[model samples]
Target: MTTNYKTSFLLPHDYEIPTFNYPQYVLPPVPYNYQPYTQDIWSANVIQPLKTKITAPAQCKFDENKYLNLFSGEFNECYYDFEIDLKEIDPTIQSISKFQDAYKTIEISNLNNLQIKCATPYIENFINDRNVNLTYGNDNCEFDDGLLSNITLKKEGISQTDDINFENTITLYTNNIKVNDIETKYAIAYTNGLPSGDYSNDYITKTKSNVDFLLQVTKLSNNDNDKIKETYLQVYYTNDVKLKIRFSKVLVAKLIRMFGYLYWGNDKNIVIDINNSDTLGIKNNSDDPVKIKIKPR
Candidate 1:
């Protein structure tokens, strides 16, 4: 009892909890009006995403704004040209006389690489006997009526000239017994690349989906059976990010269709209505894409 020591211990006590007040979040003001979207604002925010995704995939992020910026940028248009030649010849008088007794033959070389084909009912009366004393006339030997029997073409071994590139050649041929009476003419058709069906599935569409870009032909607005000299091509893309990203898939598909007809030697320039039914739904998903499909306006 004399050695008892004093002991003290701490005890738990209850206290009122403190109240917390969180500040309200405020969204930043958008630079443009938020309403029925205009082409100007939408272009800055939407369709651009589609193009950026397809054009530069590695540099693209899922962010709508950056994609839109890429989409809004301009695209380079492809141009190409093709050259053709026609040659004429006359066989020896003895060859023509011998042909009367047999099926006369005329051979044309230098045509193995072109898409050349002749029309129906080839012309006749191309050969005459030496005793007939018939005078050959240039007007009588026209290429427009030939049957186009055989054709061949070879790529001209040369580099690109003045932004002018060689695509492929097209040759037309026919064999007339009257070789001396035949004449030939060369016809050339020109083009300003091919048309862009839609920009949705374009290479850039995956990154910049929401943009609404348009390709306009501002010059050479007529292709109705006339020679085309020069034409203008204009590209329109949106600048908005959110809109661009949201519609990336659709935009990619559209862009693929938009330039479906662009090739090396398509020199036709005419009023092509973007809303034509035949011009719709031309794009599809594929590992490798190619532009094919020629349309007449």
Candidate 2:
């Protein structure tokens, strides 16, 4: 067995095919550096230096107060001194002279000084002279003189006084009315088909007329006599084509009225109170077990 190993056959070698080597793709350089740029480069080098070197156009300032005071007088100075003895002075002549002096002394420098010192820039100036007749002066002159000949002074107190008095009187009168004297009327209507249990499904119908719907009334008194009142009503019904079906907890109560009375007698007028809760109940099924309780007023 050691000498018989010489008869061997040569077999074809299975070799793997070589793949194509694609060149490594290099990315193009970015236009900007990837690293974050610092603020010193943007502010000092780009923005601040340019801003510091550029000079802006100067803005012209026009002092309104200065202009007005220069043309007028001291800010708070009254146009006319009532305390001054004018009995010996003719008002017409004095007014004429004041007008002349005002027209002559219309300068901006004086106006500016007056504006600087006065709280209000609306200053007035006047000069007095004899032998000239004066009918009336300007607005500022009138204001300074406290002579509201042309202007209508609003009497806020007087206008409000009547309203206050009327409100009080009406309120007092309303405090005496009774609750039951206030009456309200409402009309309601609905159609109901008969239940299948009662008759054949031939659409039997029933209607109720002027049913004495009961209402409950409550009186809320602010004082012993001034009473606010509320009225409530409850209603119920149901729809049945075959057997009567009761709606699931679908009932609503509504307040009909919150009223105030002007008098406590039988003929008293009722004023509706805007603030109160009133409710009414609606039942969709007549056969459904429902209870309506009308409490005494």
Best by lDDT: 1
Per-residue lDDT over 179-271 for candidate 2, one digit per residue giving the tens place of the 0 to 100 score: 232121111111121112211001100111010110111111222111112111111111210111111111111101011211111111111
What shift in Å separates residue 97 of candidate 2 from its native position after superposition? 70
Ten-residue segment with the worst summed lDDT in candidate 2?
158-167
True lDDT of residue 233, candidate 2: 16
For residues 73-102, could you state the per-residue lDDT of candidate 1 as single tens digits? 333222211111111011311332322222
Model 1, position 1: C-alpha lDDT score:
44
Pick out the ten consecutive residues of candidate 1 with the lowest summed lDDT: 241-250
TM-score of each: 0.16, 0.10
